[model samples]
Target: MNSIVNKSLRRLYLLGKTVRWGMRPCPAGARETRLIAGAQRSGTNLVMDILERSWEADVYHESDPRAFQVYRMRPLPIIQELRKRSRAKCFILKALCESQDLPELMEQLAPAKAVWVLRNYNDVVNSMVISFPRTHEDLQRIAQDRKLGGWRTEGMSEQTYRLVSGLVKRHGDALTNASASALQWYFRNVLYFEKGFYQHPDIKLLRYEDLVTQPQRTVSGLFEFFGLPYHPWVHGMVFSSSLRKRPAPELLPEVAELCEKLWQRFQELEKPQSI
Candidate 1:
């Protein structure tokens, strides 16, 4: 199929870029490690793809085995070694799964900075239900505290766990995939507030809507945060077609109310630094 061929060609092109960038001479002085963190389906991929197009930075996607294992980021020591070896001035890494540990990770990887992206709950839930059919089932276990072992439940504050558990108890198995995915969004994103990220100077907040609608301004602000100069190649890599493209899914009344409150909170917190 043409789609498959196109995907293959894209991978080859990216590989060529990575290989060529890796061989460049290391710039003088220390290299800054930049991290991209967010909940799944929250435009992290788009951001990473655009960043990868930059010749001044070296990217280590979560799928990169050198920095990740089974899509989760590898240990800090391994990441440090990779940072040390990269020749670029900025060593960029994507760590969505390890978002909960970012505060500590940033401390350990000092001279590091991060961007935590936020997206609309309705859109994120829509994408989750379609891309991950088993999400509802997985979240049921997470809500009931039956599966505390997975990354979904990791670093979950007791207060957050109780809130999600109570919601599941109220609706029982009657909860729809949309609502479940929304709760997943809540639990993961609430960590931004619960972990005191609002006070963290090195971690910046970015909105998915802003990045898509105003790509140049938003990304220029992001690059400024990372202390990297913006390049023109990233312009063609982002488009606004995905903005509010999907119909909002049917969510339970309680879940909808909960997500709206959290969404409003993010809006308030993100106002001052709007690009």
Candidate 2:
């Protein structure tokens, strides 16, 4: 009950700011959609919550029926209509499932920008095991049945599919749920490279660790990239308690190495490039 009231109060505060800021014309003088994409257990929700506190933005959570149907995005036309109807200058949408199609979606919604959040695989798997107990079984099906089509398999390349299948085959029935969940993380995030996001000017890679440990600077940088005004209160809700809260989930040595390699790649990418 207290949580509900707190959420409502936060909304009221943001709405007041919206009305105050809405009196003036938007700085950009045009609407912009900010797509937040990442694996399910990554820190996408944390970023979304921060942006939702902004006066200039309207948020569409994956559970919002108006923008999503069972976590999959509604049709493009419907999405465009939602953006058109919203009075806020920024339309914030969570598109974790549609992450692989980010490039195409950005082109279709030109003037849109995206941020893909990366969390440590160990932490992500830990959260997934608790939040979605079915993840391991679900991923097992995807590995054994390549024809299974859903958000999990959608946009998955043949190369990645084979890689997952091969990994599962090596472990056979001995694959632990934690390991399966880790593999799920691997294939989903690998698309960041497979889709050529490294060179995509409009897309930014965000590290979950950075956001929690250095919320102010990290979020300020993201706001700058998206051209949204910064608000101190936006990052207030973020807490670092979740970081390494539990011993890293045990996984097969090979799977651990794979996830670690990808994690290091994300860290390297987070560093600023030479001009």
Candidate 2 lDDT by residue in tens digits, 1-275: 99999989977887786676567645544978889998988999888889987777788899899999999999999998887767777888999989989988887766799998989999999998898777667767777787663787777889988888888887777788889899989989998888887778888888898899999999999888888899888899888998999999999999999999998887777454100
Clashing pairs in 1: none
Candidate 2's clash total is 0
Backbone clashes under 3 angstroms, per model: 0, 0
Runs of candidate 2 exceeding 4 Å displacement: 14-29, 273-275
Clashes of 1: 0
- How would you encode candidate 1's per-residue C-alpha lDDT over 1-275 as one tens digit per residue? 99899789778876776677667656646777888987999999888888876767788888889999998988788888888777777888897889999978877776789999999999999899888787777867776664653888888899988888888877877888888899999999999889987778788889999998888889988888888779766767688888778788889998999999999998887554433
Candidate 1 lDDT score relative to the true structure? 0.83
TM-scores for candidates 1 onward, in order: 0.91, 0.93
Candidate 2 lDDT (Cα, 0 to 1): 0.84
- Who wins the lDDT comparison? 2
